[model samples]
Target: MAKGSNCSRWVLCSLVKLVFNDAYISTKIHHRQVSPLRRPPTAAIAGRARVPGFGTRVNRVCVRAVISEGDKKKTMVETSKELNESAVESGGWVDVRAVITIRKKMKENLNEKIEDQWEYVVNGMGQGICLQLISDQIDPVTKSGKSIESYVRGWMPKPLSHPHIVAYMANFKVPHDFGCPGAILITNFHGKEFYLTEIVVHGFKEGPIFFPANSWIHSRKDNPESRIIFKNKAYIPSQTPPGIKDLRREDLLSIRGNGKGERKMHDRIYDYAPYNDLGNPDKGEDLARPVLSGEEMPYPRRCRTGRPPTKSEPFSESRIEKPHPVYVPRDETFEEIKQNTFSAGRLKALLHNLIPSIASALSSSDISFKCFSEIDKLYNDGVVLKDEEQNIIDNQFLGNLMRRVLTAGQQLLKYEIPAIIKSDRFVWLRDNEFARQTLAGGQPKQELHLHRMSVEEAIENKRLFILDYHDMLLPFMERMNSLPGRKAYASRTVFVCTRTDYPYAADGLLIWSAIKELVESYVEHFYPEPGLVTSDLELQAWWNEVKNKGHYDKRNEPWWPKLDTKEDLCGILTTMIWIASGQHAAINFGQYPFGGYVPNRPTLMRKLIPHEDEPEYEKFIHNPQRFFLSSLPTQLQATKVMAVQDTLSTHSPDEEYLGQVHHLQSHCNSDHQVQIMFKKFSSKLEEIEKTINARNKDIRLRNRSGAGIPPYELLLPLSGPGVTGRGIPNSVSI
Candidate 1:
């Protein structure tokens, strides 16, 4: 199996199990249970004792332990370094392991599981074995009382003692364990340190699988993380995010660990996750994006800011005392929020438009050019005209022809750049910026038809959709957004003509369907009935937390769906998934590819179209392209944005794609239902890839496979490392 495939296999216990069966380990130092928060004392604690046993008294040792769970049938072991002469002065070996007791009813299949596991350890790892045994005279995991026994039993070919094992520690302690047993295989039979290059988990519906160990258990010094699988079986340390999910359309940057010292791991989450859950604030705030403050000092060139296209501009939300996810710049730093603001900051949409797949490509606020390269080429061909000396001429402009094919607007004059650029000969479609922006991809309008089609007829035919961002943002444009080097408009939005919209929507549906199916199956398995959905306390808690914290400003909006039925829950999950994966992928990966060409998707329109009588127009008649380039983002902003885009768009080697979400370390033998459904989801994604491949080949899809058009495969599920302009990760892992 490839490294990015399956995650470690132990399944996490649910809320019920968390509440009732959690396991914890503590020993008295000053004759009291050690505080989980207090760091272990180090100055006088560098020694070990030769004694080995648990249940009688605290015997201090210098070596650390790599612990795992033990049962009659199945067992896993983990080992550490040999006794530290320097630190092995004296200390008790804490039996921080869960010893599970199986009932007679569950014993029928217990032997089979044991046999399989025994074969797994013996055949895969080989002989000369050592095993420990202990009855629950005193429960070792939770010290309701004292002295719990510690032991492991596995098969080995020869009889030999595995000695001198050492255990490493991290900064903090591990979290609680639900009823699930701890797990791992450890041996000191060999002298060299055994690094976990891979971890194979069994019992998933897809059978046994090996995943990259670095993703979870990083024993290497570079990214040292070696937490026991049972450490956070019930919960890991996590924090509720402060409304950063909306950044980059949804940046759920969080952690998924509680391992101390070398066992520390940095994991990400989706929504409101358990302290150990990588989905929410529990640990996400640690990775929350810092707001970019001030601005990059414009480069050597004379940087210019256009007049407020609208009188009002917003530096923040309209009615808030401070933005909900208020971004305060750190120090006087001049760095972009590259991690959280993928698409927008790519071209620095905060200064221009182009909110990625989130804002419709049609909206003045969102630039949808990656999939519209052909149209941009046509816009360049027919509209950009020049004389023998390269001066732009108004009469020579292909006005009528442009009107026939593109969304052309009234001509304007006087926007200029004193640099080499002479005039505003590049006439931007400012006439109906609203129409140009929103008509193509609104929510309900569905209006991307031929120019000849009547608006009423188009609407009647269901060719239009509008998300109504114009009114929502208009009020703040004049007040909060008017920073220097910015172009703010009241009625900016996204529009898409089903035909011209290219693959964002069409191909995105492929990903959406697979995600929806997986979410639905998961919901069915967990909820089972509407009543179950309504009664689910944790589920509702998560939903309420998302709204109150994620969209705190708009939590009162009437559109918030009540979680009364499973269908409602499914819809919510699907929408969030689409935003994070498919939609984000569409707007993202294409950053440098589309935004690299400044003329096509201008970052900021510094100069407006000059009127024929204006002096700028006279300059426009002299040199056109330079004037056009000057109207966009200044060279400084453009180059900086490009650099930022390159970094953001490139997928790292450890990327986890949409259907390939593993790395979730399990602490117990897994349940097969959800894993089976996830496996099917992955299969469906493969099917989607084939369909997209076929679509790109068929000449029937003109926008997709037409001449001069790059085959629209940005939505294809797989991609190699780096910025190949594809791959939909499971979440916005900012």
Candidate 2:
């Protein structure tokens, strides 16, 4: 070899090693995973597998001999040289060329190979539309099969011109010799009816005759391949042929069910109110605009999108605007009381909005209220209250925390007792029998049973026992019962509120075991399809296809690799259960206050924002609206004062807050604070709506330009005709 060629080969080899030997190289061949027993020999001199020579700390030879074009063994260098040369011959980068070749091969494999006469229905825009056709006895002259017009099974792909297009095509007679070639019947001519002026015949051994106007133009019908033609009125025959049939009338009547007419509305089986106001025009306007009438004022209803689906009743309106404001008697006088009563009056209204159950429990005559004290035995045997990370607190800490929250709430209500029922966060009232039984210095087991009885009675009576601090409550119960701590917060809450639901205690082990059994049963009964053979080779082929689709990226970011092992499948199902059961929220809320982090794992829900210019917009949005809703209070409720004088002394109004309150001089002076707060909230909601609208517009624009498919289009019918229900069990445990 010449010196220059030899040097070039040496340089190429060096370059290949530098590029492929690094950690950045994702090729499996470069980073083969070997068994522990068969360790690489170069790894500190134990018996291990290694390339025979040329091993360095940073690099190793990753090439071997492969059979070449003539089935002769070729060294790695020779193979590389040949592949690189072929890539150069094809032009562009080697990877790009390979991708292009694979695509071309796929297209060739997909092309239909048939030997029957086929006709494509072409629209006015020159686009071909397909319909299933059934061919019958062949014509002797054309040697092409003919299909009965009635047996042609397809709805019109789109509206066609009945007066012109359909009438003209029906007048044509099939060519006798060499079979009439496929013909394109043009519809929707000049953006009107599918007129018979333009007809293109293609890919046939012979062509057909057309009759439209009185005149006609004759062409060489024997020629199978001919240029497309647009004939005028001259194409029509002077008189009907003796053997020809007048078929246009039948065609016109048959094509009437093309859905060109308006659709009729059908009555529904169930009478449902048009409650989906977001889509319904009648209600949609009312959402943002208020209705006003004589002697009645208008106000926007509270948007409940973030509230629980179980609650049916609409939230009560604030009584801050009530006709008769509650009077507070101060030596300071009545005028200032009306203005300062704005927050207090609303809080009182919120209390009445509470579901019946909670109202009954809190208002029960037998219930006793107590200030939390150390004598209440609020301590565990060994657990200490500490501000340490991951330190599990016992039931005592929960009780103490509840007391503190209640105390803070009491301090917040500084007005007359009417709003007192709404202001306190937790009502520490228990029925006389339960309080007497539990706090009677009894055994822990007895106390626990008594507590359980109280809870049971409350449930039985449909009375709500609101555990204001459930994140602490459930875990504390788990600790007291000697249950596992990691999933102590996984229990579901039972009580329903505007913002949250009370969780019911659940055993994680039992739940997980049930899940495992269900998954096993489901997979055993339905996972294996008769034709789907998931051998190693098949799986690897699927993986390769997935990777080529641009789905596989760095560390599988933004894409979940197909489940190749039972363990991976189980892990995924575990995550799905965690998310679906809402246990994720329970644990997260328990661990953090006001904020929690969701792990960067695959999720079932995808949120996309097309309007944002940054690629990181989706990550940043993280559904801020939900977070905002949770952080803000939906309703303000008051609590009737218990130990009124003491509570008032401790929570004397701050000068800053007092200064902000509007003074009520005249009876007509309205509580302007409520209006101000409502206006601010409405403005914030409008901003959010604008953002969502902008994103939707961006998505619509993208869909129009074919830049992206709408998310809704990804849905396909889960079950349909020909989707047999056999083999799969009708009832599977879940």
Candidate 3:
């Protein structure tokens, strides 16, 4: 038998026994066809198999062998079934055990995977090596708190070589268990001093990081060692003693310190004291002070006392005090006093004598023969000339002379006369002279027809004269007409006067014409009867028309129609006065006073008359013939009274009387004897009144109605009530 066959037979016999639940080995062999092995095995065989000596000693083994083919097949099938059943029963618990074992092993493997992936530590920082500088508990020599020595000693792994450690004190004191993982000091183990360059936290922690190299702690002089050397293991002193050298050493000692001394030292080093001590003790006194104890101390006394006695007081005999009297010559002194005396006396005399003369000359139709002489001189000197018809021929010369005379006369009248009359001395003199003159005069012949014809002719001649001199008069008239125009002319005169040396007399002439126009207009409007209209509506309409005309235009039609109606005539007169009076006097004198009477009174009859008891009328009537003499100078007296009244009524009592004189002078004519005529008329009227009053005394006593009868009625009494039986009393009774 081949070795493989023998081995197969033995394995089958052993499998049969084991399956059948027998302990004995099966020795019998069934005859079966075996196929030859297809290939030899590669590995060397180790064990030898005993092939039962083919049958030599076939022991009586309890081997069950089936002989029939069918039976053998059945036995084999049953054995296979039984073996399967036994295998199932035996290994059933093994599968369950295996599953359980596998689950437990899987659980262990999962746990190992989790352990490799994640980790946990006490601080939030992952496990890593780190270096930290421990904060100092003590302050440095500069008194900077928290020196670095303490830090190095406490947490450095080894002694430092270049110790550059900065010390930091927390803004708030930190607790011992503030969760700081502690710190490490990076240093050379062998070096005596260590320089701390950087600080790193090993774990999740917070700290005020410090570098020892750049800090005051490492800059100490005495204690030069980099590493902190602890002395006794006693509790580091809570407060460091004053004179520490190295702040790091002080820190190592765990001493408490402040920055007061450090600040003071820094201030000293930097010379940062606000005050300086000069070499002079006096200068330095303000900077330093000696220590004081217990009792209060007074302020330091000044080194120098009060100022040295003045030179004058100490040395009395240096200079003499003498009164210097100014020496004035007798002539100069007397002359000064005389001049002052003359100024006062001259003004008084001038006003006393001149004002009345001027007033008289202006009010009278008679010009001084001397004035006419001057006029003749002007003509002879070729300053003036006359035409063949005996009229003023050189219009320019006439106009110029007229203007000068007029202006000088007007200024003298208006501004100077009132001023002279206001003086008591002037008034006394004027009145006394006037009384004397009146006493010498009496009522003279009536020259009415001659005077009236002369006045009319003069007016007609003047109109023609003005036309001839229109060019010269126009500019002068325009300039004098209004304040604005006057002011413009005044400026022009100033320039012209400077350039051409034209005398102020010429300018004065223009001013005189202006005033003349003003006075004439006033007389026509307010003084004459049939006076200006008093109606406000009429006045406003007139004003509107005048304004619309806007600066008299010779070319344009006249704004004022011909004065046909009495009302229109009155308006024209009123307007004329308004322009003449410079608006101011017109509004007050003419409009307010006269206008108020227009509605009730006959305008022409409103003349100023003397009261019954007045001495003026009686004095005039005493010498009526002399008063009425053709050459008598009554105009000045009239002008004096008028000026006095004007001054009393108006606030400007000191205005010149010469202005009034000039106005009257302008009206003088050769043919008209106005001065004598006016005087005669006045004297005659007074006489008539005196005569009637004297005769009616008894009648007045009997009848109360005729008590205060006016002189006008006395002259024409027979025409009215007093002369007939229907006299004043009867008229009143009726």
Candidate 4:
């Protein structure tokens, strides 16, 4: 029965091996069967253990032929396959599958954690590097990959590498209701590395730590490649207040220092202590006394440490001091005081210098009245005129003085005279003299006559003196006209002569004649015109007849018109020459004298004495009456005849005709009227057309050999239309 049961077990295992394929387990089970530990010792144990109720051990012995090793090996492989199948049925592979799944999940989780941690590390490393760069420290390595290590090393306190300090930096939560963390690191743009102590972030004693990543690094050198540097130390919290709690996990993580070499933490401890305690007593006292004196002082020892102690001590009575009064010396003696006043020479000099200043000061209307009063006093006191250099105070002096004062004042004080005061106020003061001259009542008759006579006599005397003086100065005048700049003063004399008109007297005529003679003589010498006959044609003809009769320019006969009329002759000759010298020549009739009607007048009656050798005159001698008769035609032409003389009639004289002639003469002489005439004549196209038409007619008539008046002669009648029938002859030939 035991042998049968064993055979059954082997068959079941073989069936199981056919169902599951597990080569590795099957190989392991085959090796175990071949070992001695799996030998039939189990057979001896089976026989010996059979006692009492034990079942009988089954043993089977069969004679077997000798088999080859290869067959033996094949049987062993098959048996091992059966054992492996048995192992699979018992579920031994489940544990191995579970272990592989768990391992894969763990690997994925670890990779994610590494990635997250690397990001934080990179950010922190970048911030630390930037802080070092801003502080202008040389980075240890040129490669960007070493930037994190370099920066961490740079920020450390004295005796501690920057990396060591970074490693030891801590962060904690504040005790207050504020939700911020305890500590922070501040890197400033000015290359300042600051450890911000007692920071009240979120209203808490222990504040959050902030490692700034985005702050710009400002460079110290101007070049682009120069490293940026901070101006101050980095800011980090010194210590946390006692009793702070409820810190965050992240805060704690941020505080953890990266493990580096030896930590020299004493530097941080010293930084937290009061500055006065950091140094020796003598050094501290020397630095502190100046700040406590309340006078201007240097910075105290504590000020170097970020927080300066407050200067809030109250002053005590012991610190007060007493005051003293001041005393001034006084002067005596009236004479001494008077000496202090300006002396005459000094006053003169002061007045001379201050004239301009005073004028400028007075230019302001507000001060002008006072200045005027002062100036009047000075003038009354003879200060302005009594000085020997009074002539120096001419118009130029006053003008320059006023200008300088005004300019100086304007530059110095920016004070200027108002425009109105500068223009009109001074003009009134200088021009209004009537108030001083006018009296309370009319003058006495005798006094008035005396005054009138005195004025008249003064004028007449002055006129006579000027005439005599001009006569004596005539040679100088002739010399002046010949010179250039040398004649400037003489030019002034000429101006006075021309501007001072004395009508109805020979003075104006005499001066005018002299000037005209001088101008004509100069013209004739420089630009002469020979064979120029300047007298009226009638007078010339009469003179010619007398000369032919041997009555003039002959030894037998005397010349007519005496030397007294020499000036008149000169004037007539000068006027004729002046007029005839131009292309468009016309005499101004009013400017010349008339003749014939008043033949016996003193001006015309004067005669020249006869020369020794003579010839008897016959034509004018036989007809002395006829000599005056020849002038009748001229008289008739110049006179206004009454048309009613042939019958008995009463009418007004031809005043209108005479007036019109006067008006025409006046208009012809006026520069304004001549300008108006020329402007109108030039501007009017119709008038130019009429003139051209008339000229064309004249040209055509002349071309056709026809007798016709010239256009110019025809137009001459239109020139004095209103005075055509006046006493002046219409046919008065030029």
Candidate 5:
């Protein structure tokens, strides 16, 4: 090792002369990169840059660092060897190898970090054009597209000219009521068309194949655009009515807007009038924008996506850009796809345009939401308000904490339930299929309804409610889950209502019952007699304080139970303990497992489902996966969300849980009854944990216990620190 150090010193001096010319060293030691493959004279001329009029295939670079500490020489190496040998013998400065190894490891780590950062930068540049393949059958086109054609089911996967990149997207279920009484919703590519971008079959047949078709996944024979006319239960291939009829007057009115571009005609203010002077608005002749004649005004008829999906009516919201004939960037291969790599100059140019908006979004000092928030706000606003009219009553309105929302499934509006009613509401709302939907899907099992009671009885028993969003979301489930980034159960979450139903519910019930028993045991031991609860001023004061002060708003409510008996005391304590401990554990801790993988719970919905009337429909039929990817979260958004969810779901190192309440034991050690209750409570918690484990192994409860479902361990009584995802904390620790 000592010899190697001396050897490095010997080689260093000679290499400097051999590597760089006298012109590079004598002129100036410039800190710059030059491609090793480029001409030598080019570097000398530009000083630190490549000269113009040169081959720009810039690949590798040469870097140089000058050691200016008295320089390196052959005699110096001999002196360095002598110093090292003398130091090693005396052991004054020890372990030369240790220093070398540490430095080498540091360099390796630095290189690794540098490589990772470089990859991030490179991938970020290609985010718009690049995607990876996931899950292909290898069994080619069979049962998709224009169902009138017979499906043979034995078509083999054939190799195309270029390797097909399958951009895997989140697959979602659409109900029978969606998309023209069910067109392609039940089949492959059961997604609505997005008009933003086109799905292209690049290098298709090495040339244009007369009729466009999805040769990879669907059909090679049929023209995808030409519908079957859907007569008997299928119209326009599968349509109830053409997606929202025309709004032409409003389209022209937008060009001559009331604000600044007001056009006056025939002693009246005509919002849709096209004046002759269509240039300057200051000339008093209101001119229409986009510099077009009256005939060129687009969107004369109502278009499917004339406005965003969030807007229930065609022109319900204030929007001017009625993209009449939506342009589809389909079929033509992107520049990077054609060339197979993005150029440095082109990337720099793109960053030049995007960096400002990206920086603004990330920067705390000047955060901006103009890019995506407006569209998102509209989607969220569709719940109880539309067209500036508030739909929810004042009493029902629970003022928003996070700027808004509904509490669950207490109310239902006509616009919110498109899956049920085509237009107007006729059927009186009922819970006839509610129990069935929550259990074995739409199938009504006779056993499930064995204990069916009146709504009044169910409500009084406190088993009427659900974890929620089932009824609220059934209408938009297809469109909501179809989004590329976000996956939520506004439509499908209703069935998972009770504690005995699903993973969180079934396992959570074990913890709840254990705590309830603990509470009842504690109340019985403390109170002893019914009069003891009345005479105990301390207990009375505590109950009074809780009702009159803690929950002052609900102080006068009829629901408040009279604490005259031990049973009343037991119920209140059990509820308080369950809410703080088991209930919160079921909902809070499993955030990462449910959401960390962006596809499962994508944070953003980049695109909307495309309708059949758009040009994008032509492209979607060719490559469904491309549209799927675009409709969800992009690569960057998923990464960011994963990190946040992971942090949020993590447990603290010094964490406390339901069974491990040692602090309470320390204070209650003097009282034997308190000590006895704690022991029984801890024992009960352990037993509950075993029961949960047994239930997880059970195959009957398919939502959680089945092989496909992740075991419901979020309420599994015990866990260690750091994002365990499963643990019954004693309180809402998060």
Candidate 6:
């Protein structure tokens, strides 16, 4: 037989035997006398003697002793019961029988209380290798009963025998009702510590607790799977002291052991944990136990965060001696590119060029664009320009459109971000909380609902910026566009003001303020430019000067749908969406060729700072935004390599407010806006399909219908390549 086949056979046999051992133990317990269980101490004093079977069988023997004691009581209780019955028949009260019965009942209650204190450790970790302290034990220091906190503090890890072996301790708190064993699980392991002698607990009233020599086992540091497999069997310290016969911890090639020799192993209820839990050792304990705070420990970043840096952004700070150049040759000459991409004059001439996709998307907000297209078609075919009857008919059409749009707006405002993003998923699970809440009165409405601030408290508590963008801004823009088109447009010069919900609900002034803030933030992060708007007064003054200069009129002139009234705040929203959604999407596709959210943009603010309340927060779950910002600079560099430097540097921070609007209008018309949007959307779907196909090359997962890439991994940027019709040639600079 092949070596691999033999290995597989061995593993299968071991698994079978382990399963059988668990079943046998469970069945044996039922026949054996039940009694109180005593849990072991978390640690023993360092450098203590390793007595064979002492640490291993102490708890087991304690239960046996309790059972023996219970049997003695049961025998006395039976004799007392007979005496009590005779006394009752003779009509005489027997105090001896009553007292013995009471004592027996009291003894049973004591054993039950002890049993509760030491529950079996049930976890998904292949087997429970450790005992759990379910209840408070006598504090070694104070001599009074105390919680796990006090006990954990008293037992400190001993210094490693070797200089290279670095040891650290971690505590796992099992959550209540999670089917976990209640305990403060501690594992003292070392890195590069092949010859770790033993781990001893410090401070105790009784003698020190000692583990087996070479018990400080460390798995392969590089292998993630090895670290994940729990240390299931904590072998008992052999009666004989450490010598040539004993194997070193490093001798065990695998975490589950090599299954080599017929080693004597003890299997208990806690040993064969059914749940296969990770991180937590106990299910029925409080999970949110505060991380034990102490002097800053020299732990590695990956261990703490649980997220290693990607290839583009390595965690180490080692600087390259000769950095790779970002610039690459492109087809277009620098001067040619300068005119087409940089000057911003030509691009700014057409509004459709700037925001075709956005304008097309907004069409769904109203029926006027479609109706007007038909209306214009009829007029062109040979209708008179000015007809009273035609005007009245148009007014009626406008009124009905307004009524429906308003109703749709009302319906759109109450939907949450999750409901919007995963609406299909919600509908499928009819019993989902969001679905139940939304479809309460009738069948679900198809119109997109805007999220109400009152109902957004749950998302607010998470404090994620992307979630806020989804829950508030996206829906608001959809609803706002649904308003009556022309009259709403005519109500221009509405006093502009700043509001928290800028770009979505706030007037032009607020949206402009938001745009300014975004530029200022970019400048702050990248250019180190001072004197960017630092105060509200400065921003307002800047806005006033720009508005008075007729810059707005110049920017809006290129818009093709010249309906004469200037209420179109599309400039502000278009810019906002470009910054919020478009840039990240483009960057992600440039890197991973995927169509999901990109994280780690170097230019964006990081949201993964330690939470104020959780001083010792362990980030096992990485903040998506952190990755989004960290990777942004690399995306910009990639864009530079693609010869798109003009996109980065053309719009000076000073000109951003007016420049974006002017540039967008320069290249687009109303009809082209709808066409451009369709092209872009179609392109995005194609990219998504390509991404799916690329990953599904694995034959094992290909045939499974629902086995596409995981939703989290499928995360793509909101934008992609070819989004803009204009060729953004490649460069290699940032």
Which candidate should be chosen as best, given lDDT against the real structure?
Answer: 1
> After TM-score superposition, what is the CA distance of residue 534 in candidate 1 from its true location, in Å?
2.7
> Model 1 off-target regions past 4 Å?
1-452, 465-502, 661-669
Which window of ten consecutive residues has the lowest lDDT sum in model 2? 96-105
Tens-digit lDDT string for candidate 1 (580-673):
6687887887775545445535556655557798889976678765565555664345444655665567775645576664222232214456
lDDT of 2: 0.22
Query: lDDT by residue for model 5 over 347-457, one digit each (tens)?
Result: 322322232234334444322223333222312332222222222223334425212423331121111111111121221122332332232122222233315666566
Number of clashing residue pairs in every model? 105, 37, 54, 43, 20, 71
Model 6 misplaced regions, further than 4 Å: 1-128, 134-183, 188-501, 504-734
Each model's lDDT comes to: 0.37, 0.22, 0.24, 0.22, 0.34, 0.23
Residue 223, model 4: lDDT of 14
| Top-TM-score candidate index | 1
Model 1 TM-score is 0.49
Query: Sorted on TM-score, highest at the top, how do the candidates line up?
Result: 1, 5, 2, 6, 3, 4
**Global Cα lDDT for candidate 1:** 0.37
| Predicted candidate 6 versus true structure: per-residue lDDT over 392-502, tens digit per residue | 435774746644543444422121112111223223223222221111211233332224333255245431122123333444554554643211111111111111321
Question: Could you estimate the TM-score for every candidate?
Answer: 0.49, 0.17, 0.12, 0.12, 0.36, 0.16
TM-score of 6: 0.16
lDDT by residue (380-496, candidate 2, tens digit) is 111112332113222445756644643454433232221111222122122221221111211122222323446657567554433344554554755544532112222222331
lDDT of 3 by residue, 1-734 (tens): 00011112222222211111111111211111111111222321112112221112222111111111223224334533442343211221210000000000112267553532221110012111112223333223334222111111111111122121111111112233323222222212211112222221211222122121111112122232222221111111122222221332322222111111222110101101111111122324343333221134222111111122224232111121245312111111112223343444334333333434533444434232123233223213312212321232224456566546544544333322222112222231332222211211111222233223354564554411111333435566544545421211111110001112111222223333433443344324322344333322223333333322221222144554553344554444334322322232212222211111111111111112234587656644675333223122232333333333232223221121111211111211111233333334334434443444454453432211122221111121112211111111101000
Deviating ranges (above 4 Å) for candidate 4: 1-721, 724-734
